[model samples]
Each structure stands twice: as C-alpha cells, then as structure tokens.
Target: MKIATILGTRPEIIKMAPIIDEISKRNIDQIVLHTGQHYDEEMSDTFFRDLDIRTPDYNIQVGSGTHGKQTGLMMKGIEKVLLDEKPDIVLVQGDTNAVLAGALVASKLHIAIGHVEAGLRSFDMTMPEEINRRAADVCSTMYFIPTAESAINLLAEGYSRKNLFITGNTVVDACFRHLKIAKKRGIKEKSLKELNIDKMDNILTLTMHRAENVDVKERVVGIIEALKELDDADIIFPIHPRTKNTLEKFGLFDELNNLEHVHIIKPLGYLDFLLLTSASTLILTDSGGLQEEAITLSVPSLTLRYNTERPETVTAGGNILVGSDREAIVSNARKILDNKNFADKMKNAINPYGQGDSAKLTVDAIEDYHARGLLDIVAPEDIMNSFKRKMKNIREDISVKDFERKENALVHMVFDGKNMQFPTDELNLNGMVINYDKRE
Candidate 1:
C-alpha cells in the first residue's frame, strides 16, 4: 500500500522524520508532501537537511496568510496532488492547518487518514490548534496515539478501540536518533562556539512563538520582563520568525536584543537545536514538542502558557506551567536554576512519551492494520448516512431552535459523482431536507 505523509511546519517535519525513514525501509510506496507553512530556508529546508529527511515529493508554497486563506490554499494544493497520486492512506502528524486540510481532503476523496499524534486535546477552543486536532481526529480512520492518556481520551470520545493503537510518540524516536547524529558530528561544541558561549552550564534555552503568547503585547512584555529578571543564566533564544516579527512590530526586538543575558539568535536547525536542548540547564518555552523533548532529555522546562495539550510533561514533573506572568516565570526559572534538588527532581522524572522505538511501533502498526484490512476507506455515502443517523438521534433530544442552530453551524457538503453539493435550504427538526446547488 502507498502512504502519503503531509507535513507543513518545522515541528511536524522533525516529528515525522523517523516514521518517514521507517516507511522508506519497508516495502511501502511513500510520498512526502510539504505545505510550506514554514517558508523560510532556516525554518524549513535546514531541518530537512539536519534530520537527513529526503526532499519532499511535493512542496506547495502556501506560505503565511490568514488562517482561512492558508488552510484553503493547502486544501486546494493537497487535493490536486492526492487526486493525481491516489494514495491508499494519507498520514498527518501535528495539528497544523496542513493536517486539517490533508485529513479533510483525504476523507472527502474516501482515502484512509492516519493521524500519527492523535487524541491530543488542550480543551481550549480558542486555540486554533485545538480545533485543528479535533477536526483531524474526527476525520481520521486510524489513530496512532502517543500515550495511554491519549488513548483514554479517544476511548472517552467514543473512538473505536480496534482502530486506536497506543504507539508511543515518534518525537522520542526522532529525538534519540538525531541527538546521536548531533553528538557524532560534535554539534554541541560547534553550537556553543557559534553562540559565543564558553560553557553549557546555567544555560536557559528560551523559545516562545505561540500566537497567544507572542501576539499580545502585554504577554510579550511580561515574558521579556521575566527574562530580564533572570540575569544570572545565559538565555539562548533561537527566536522563531513570527516571534521576531512580532517583537520588532512592538519595538521590543531591540529591547530584547539589548538585554545582556538574552541571546536572540535565528532559528537553529533540528540537530543544532537538539544539541542545545540536550546541553541546556533549563528550558523556557510555550512549545508542545519542546515539552516532550525536555522530558526526553532530562532537562527542566517552564511552559509559558496558561494550559498545555501535553499535560504528560507537567504531570511527569519534567516541566512546569508558568504562563506569561512575569512573577511566575521569574519564580519558576529561579526555582529550577537556584535549587539543585528541585532541578534534580525534574531532571530525574520519568519520560512519559515513550522509548525511542516509537517509529518502528508506528510503522509496524500501520502495516499490520493494512494487512488486516482495517485501513479500508469508508464510502462517502456510508459516512453521510451514518452521520445522518446520528443527527436523527440527536434530533430526538434537542429543541427545534437548537437543532436549527447546530445544523446551520455545520457546512453541509456531500460529493455527488461529478460535483460537490452543499445544502442551501433550512431543514426542520421533524425531518431533514437538503437542497443541493452546483458551485461550478
């Protein structure tokens, strides 16, 4: 069977690397598609080179845009390639717009979708990632969950146990694999020299690029103020391009740059960053992948967010949630930096993600599922009929107004052999009536 892996951002590339490499080793036809969500050479191309990932088969340059525009463009681009290649299954990793678009397109075309890091929920609908992940999960045919907790989440959500496999996170696989390469290449010494750091001790690696934290000026100022307080530690911030643009927009780039201890460098390649992560005494960031990496590397981390989707790290005691509050950030950083016992406790916490063999497990699960005929695509008509039956059951409990509200909120689209059909007429609660209009 053929597999088409869709990835966009740098994190997706890093996490999907091991799985892609594994697919290459097996007797499977694999296609890699890049959405170019991260367009810069530093952010995108450098990572492929660092991880030794083969050049993507397709790169639709759907660069930065508003969420709607970006996702739409990705859907259009991905659908074209998928239709041309007609792969049996489409694999998507993280909850980026690319994942959402890839899953939606694959589902519409009746191709199986395998969500690699499925069943992650931050529960905050305001975060676009939460929505993207949930939507992708709904559209997925196979869920390759990372942890037991994630599996429980899927079970609670009524996902079939047969399709849910707790294949430990592939980030573990990528981390160990790339770190070995980095060590062999002496990346640690090279990175330290490049960053002008004489010692790796007391290093605080900072990375904050979440839209929630960086978009708000108040939050950005608060985080920077907290960083200013921690002058004792060397802050090696490989700044994300978006965060840099936002800082410069708010006139805080120069202020952050001028800070004595904070080193605002361009985004590092995966190997270099992995080396830095391994060497850091403490990490401060709002990234989900970094939280898992921190636990894997036995480093203490402070998550600068109100809540995280990767609560495993926090529960395992490897990471702490300090949010964007200046005091909380400062207090936590100091605790990890000054108190050796506390730092040791965090460093010695169990890595809940998994052992480094997750890629093997993930690929093995996929191959097994396919052999068992569990990855077959459900027909669109069957899917719609099933959805309609569920909606009919829901119609029994809700008021007519509530039903109408819910139905209107949904984009009622169905494929009709040659064209797509969207319901234009309002359906009453008594019975459903869908009027189709040809868009073309």
Candidate 2:
C-alpha cells in the first residue's frame, strides 16, 4: 500500500517526523509532499535536514498567499499529484492549508484520508485553523486523535466511532526522540554558552507567529509593552519569519531590538529550539506546540492567545492564557517569575499529553488496515488481537473490523461560492459534497 504524507509548515514537519521515521522502519512505500506554505529554506529545508528525514518526493511550492489563494493553489496542485500517484491513502497532520487541501483533493479522488492530529478544537471559529481542522475531520477516513478529550470532541461532532483511535500526541514521540539527539550533541549547553547566558538564569522563551496576534498592530504593540515589563529577565525569542515581517511592518522592530533583555534571533532548527525550550526557566508564546512541549518538560508557560485547542495543558497547571493584553501579560509573567512556589508547582505538574509511543501506535494502525485488505495474508480477528496486544491502550471496543474498504462515492462540492448540483443517482467519487466556500 502506498501512503502519501503531506506537510507544509515547520510545526507539521516536527509533528510528523516520528511517523515518517516509523514508516521508513517498516519499509513502507511512502511519498512525502511539500506544499511550501513556509517556502523559505531556513524555515522548511532546515527541518528535513535536522530531523534526518528524506527529502520530499514532490514540492508544489505553493508558498505564502491569502487563505483562499493558498488553499486553492494547493488543492489544484495536490489533485494532479493524487491523479498521478493514485495512492491508497493520503495522510495529513495538523490544521494547515496543506492538510485542508490534501483532504479535499483526496476526497474528490476517493483516496483514503488519514488525519494524524484529528479532533482538535479551540472552539473559536474565528481562527482559520479551527475551520481547517473541523472541515478536514469531516472528510477523513481514519481519525488519529491524540487524547481521550480529542476523541470525545470527535464523537460529539457525530464522527463514526469506528474511524477514531486515541493514539497519544506524536509530539511526545518527536520530543523524546529529538531531545535525546539534542543532549547527545550537547545542544543545550552549547546554545547557552554561545548566547552568553547561563542555564540557571531566569529565561523566558517567546514565540509569536499567530496571524491574530502579529497581524494586528494594537495587539503587537501590547505584546511588546508586556515584554518590556520583563526587561530584567533573559528573553530568548526564536523569531518566526512572519512575526518578524509583521513587526517590521508595524514599525516595532526597532523597539523590540533595542530591548536590552530581549534576544531576538532567527528561527532555530528543531534541535536548537528543543534544546532552548528544555533549558528555559519559563516559556511565553502563542504557539500551541510550545504549550504542549512546555507541559511535557514541566516548565511554566503563558500563552499569548486568548484560547487554546490544547486546554489540557492549562488544566494540568503548566500553562496560562494571558492573551495579548499588556496588563494581563505583564501580570502573569511577574506572577510566574516572582512566585517560586507557583513555578515549582507548574514544574511538578503531570503532562496530560502522554508518554512517547504515539508513532508506533499510529504506524501499527495504518499497517493493520492495509493488511486487512489481503485475505490471503491473515484473519481479521487475529489481526485485531495483534493490534490490540501491540497497542494496549487502544479503546476496548475499537476492532480491526472497523477498517472499511474504500470505493468512490457521490460528492457534493462547492466551487467558489456556489454549490454545484449534480444528478443524485450519479454518485461516484467520494459521496460527500465538500463545501470549499465554507472556509471563506
């Protein structure tokens, strides 16, 4: 069985590394597709090299554009590839234009769609990612939810229980894998020494790339003011390309650069950033991945966003949502810095994400589904037991029998803003009508 894995952003690359590693180990014929959502080599190519991942088989080079333009171009590009390769399954991770486009095009071709990080919801529809994830879930044939809460979210959204699996977050697997590599390479020690900073110092790791935060001038200024309040602490910020552009556009780059304690540097590779995150005293960011990583490492964190898709981290006492309100941001930072007891409590808190075996479970699920198609290979019942035994934490009621054979179905799709009506009896490729305009 051929598997097509589609990715675009750095976050997607980081999250998908372990799954790619597992697929390679199994000698699966997998193809990697790059959408170029982050087209810069520093942001994209560095990740593949750092993670030791094979170069992408196809690079559409969609790069950056408006939401509609990006997704539209990606959909067109991915559809041609799907037609050429005709893979049995197309896998996409997280909520990006790439995932949405992959899901859309594969659904049109009746290819099996597997969403790696399915069922995540910040419940804030204003965020583009929320819409992308929800829409992708609707078209997915396999849903690999990272937590029980995520599974519950999918079920509540009326997804088929048979399609869902509660594999832990693959970030845990990637973090564990990369952190070991980082330690072996002495990355953390070397990074601190190079930066002229000590590991024991009060360090605030900041990352802000969310469009909602940086795109708005008022919000960006507020965040800067809040950062100024923590001028006494060492701030290590791995500036995202978009964030840097937005800062410059808003005329706040000079102010931020002049901040004595704020050390703004170009984006780091996965190992460097992971090492930096591991050694930080506190993490302040708008990134969802960082929130989870901070929780895994037991570091105190403050999220600049008003809401998070990963609320488990906050409930576990590892992260606080401070938004971009200057007072709130400053207050929370001061609270975490001044209250040693609070920081210690956050450090000791249990990570709700999970221990690192998510990649193995994900690959096992994929292989089990593929093997089910060959009657000459193994009995379905035995395959089910083997999968269950291998992945002990799998839901008790989920069985290998849940895997469905794929065939074309009638689809209702909207091109542009209009719903195109076709003869009802002529249902063929992916019976579901996809409303692309719903995102617009």
Candidate 3:
C-alpha cells in the first residue's frame, strides 16, 4: 500500500524521519508531503541532509500565518495533493496544522489515516496543538500511541479498542537512531565540543515557537523573565526564526542584546539538537517536542506553558510544569536546583517516553493492523493472544493452528497524527478499571 506522509514543522519532520526510513526498507511506496509550515531553508534543509531523508515528492508552500489561516491553507493545498496521489493511507506526525489538514482531507476523501504520536492530552484547551491533536485523534483509522499512558488517554476518549496500538514514542526511536549513527561516526562527541559546553556543567536548554507564547506581549515578557533566571547558568537556546521575530516585535530582543553568556543562536538541525539535548543538564521550553525530548535525553525540564497535553512528562518526573508565570517560574527553578533528591530521581527515573525502538514498534503495529485486515493473518486465537500481550503485559499461549499460515512481511511504516481511537474497558489503569470509554 502507498502511504503519503505529511509534515510541516521541524519537530514533526524529525520524528517522521525514522518511520519513513523504516517504511522504505520494506519496499513500500512512500510519498512525502511538505506543507512548508516552517519556511527557514537552512533549518528545513538541514533535517533532510543530516537525517538522510528524501526531499519531498510534493511541496505545498503553505508558509506561516495565523492558526486559522495556516490550517485553512494547508487544508486546501493538502486536499489537492491527496486528490492527485490517491494513496491507501495518509500518515501524519505530532500535532501540527499539517497533521490536522492531512487527516481531515484524507477522512473526507474516504482514505484510511494513521496518526503517530496519538493520544497526548495536556487537559488545557488554550493551546492550538491540543486542539489539533484532539481533532486528528477523532478521525484516525489507526492510532499509534507513543506510550501506554497515551494509549490510556485514547481509551478514556472513547476511541476504538481495535485501532489503538501502544507503540513507544517515535521521537525516542528517531533520536536514538541519529545519536547512534553520530556516535558510530564519532560525530556526536564532536558536535558537543563544537558548542564549547560539556555534559558536566549545569545547562538549561530552551525552545519556544508557538504563537500564543510568541505573538502576545505578556507571554513574551513572561518568557524573557524566566529565561533571565538562567543568566548565571549556561543557558543554550537554539531559537527558531518565528521566536526571534516575536522577540523583535515585542521589544524582548534587548534582554539578550549584547548579552555575554546567553547563547541564543539559529535553530540546530535534528542531529545537532539531539547531541545538544544528550549533553544538557536541564531543559526549559514551550515546545512539545522538547518536553518529550527531555524524557528521551534523561534531562529534567521546566515547561513554560501553564498546561500541557503531554502530562506523561511531568508524571514521569522528567519535567515540571511552570507555565509563563514569572515568579512561579523563578521559584520553581530555585526549588528544583536545591532539591538534589528530586533532581536525581528525575535523572535516574525510568524513561517513560519509551526505549530506543519506538519507531519499529509503531511500524509493526501498522503492519499487523493492515495484514489482519487484508490476509486474515490474525485468527481468533492470535487476536486473543495479541490482546493479552498488549493489555496484560503477559504472553498468552497460541495454538500452532493459529499461525500455520501467518507470516510477518516487510512493510513501510510512516508516522502521522489523525483521529483514530481504540477503546478497551478491560485494561486496568492505576488499579481501577472503571469504564473509561466515555471520558475522552
């Protein structure tokens, strides 16, 4: 089956790279659609080159704008592309306008949709990403949840039990792959030394790109004030162009004007950022990807947003939710600094994000879902076994007859965010299996 993968932002592009790579190795036809949500040629091109992903088969050129306008433009442009491509499924990753647009178009066009990074909820509705994720989740044919927590979130939303797959987070998968490649070539270590920083120093990595944080004067000031707390610490901020523009517009540029130590530089490519994250002491950000990346890198973070859809990071102890409140941000930072036990707990905490193989797991889930439909590869007994393994975390006995003709085949896997739900009431959550199919 042909899969058209849609991506618009830098993080989505990075996360999708591994899935695209996995899919191609299987000899499946893959179409890459770039919505141009991010317009920086230097930043965008670096991802394709550094990550070794193919250039887009189609470019929509739907550059930046208000949320409604960008989403609308993507919807129109992506809809036209879908009409021309007519692929079996559309894949989208993370929560971005491109994902919502691609999923909406595919759903309206009667094509199946697969959402990577599905079922993340911050319970805060003000953020556009939360809205985009909710919309995509409602429409997806397959939900590739990055964590068991995310899958639980989907089940709470009343999604289908059959469609949800608790695949590990693809970001971790992609990050580890690039880091591994870099280490194999002796590049990861070199990349860190180039930055004039060591892994031992206390570091606070920061990233902010959302319009809500950048476009408004209050939010911008709040961010600047919090960032100022790191004036004494080694604060590394690889900033996006939009964040720079917002800073300039709000007169927040003077905060870093001729500053000696606050390293505010152009955005780093996927591999460079991964290396930086790997060596950093802590993270401070508004970006969802950074929140997840903190967990992947085993670093602690303080989210600048008041509410988050990805609560797993906080519960996993990888991050703290400080939002934009200036005093609160400063106090929280100080508290975390003084609390060595808390810091060690986070540093040594289990990586709730996923191990390094999430991309492969996500690919396997999509392949199985498709194979079961087309070839009847999963018989009743196999289905029971699969369900037992997925829900109970226990291996179930499968009769030989169940797999007499079943064969796992090579398949291309792409990650996308579109609405897809799988509902299971039997799954025990926190010792309470109360009916959760209606809460999402």
How big is the RMSD of model 2? Answer: 11.2
Per-prediction TM-score, please?
0.82, 0.80, 0.78
Name the runs in model 3 displaced over 4 angstroms: 43-46, 66-69, 181-195, 215-231, 248-251, 335-339, 374-440
C-alpha-based local distance difference test score of model 3: 0.72
Better of 1 and 3 by TM-score: 1
Off by over 4 Å in 2: 43-46, 185-194, 248-251, 374-440
Cα lDDT tens digits, model 2, 1-440, are 88899988888887888999999998989899998888776456656876777889899998888999999999999999889998888999999889999999998787888899898899999888999999899888888888766776775565645567778898888888888877777654344457865444888999998888999999999999998989878998888877898899999999999998988887776787887888888998998888988988778999998899998788888889999999998888888889998879989888777788888898888888778762122223643323211111122322222211211221123122243322122223232223211110
Clashes of each: 0, 6, 27
Rank by TM-score, highest first: 1, 2, 3
Rank candidates, lDDT, best first.
1, 2, 3
Error of 1 at 330 (Å): 2.2
Q: Which candidate, 1 or 2, would have the higher lDDT against the true structure?
A: 1
Candidate 1: tens digits of C-alpha lDDT, residues 1-440: 99999999988888999999999999689999999987877556656776688889999999999999999999999999999999989999979999999999999999999999999989899989999999999999988888866776775576655577778888888888888888787654344557755464699999998889999999999999998999999999988878999999999999999998888776776777887889999999998999999999999999999898898888889999999999999988888889999999999998888888888888898888889887787544644334331223232434333544556433232223343222222323333332211111
Question: Cα lDDT of all candidates, in order?
Answer: 0.82, 0.78, 0.72
The total of clashing pairs for model 2 equals 6
The count of residue-pair clashes in candidate 3 stands at 27
Top-scoring candidate (lDDT): 1
Candidate 2 lDDT for residue 315: 83
Q: Tell me how far the alpha carbon of residue 411 in candidate 3 is from the true structure, in angstroms, after superposition.
A: 30
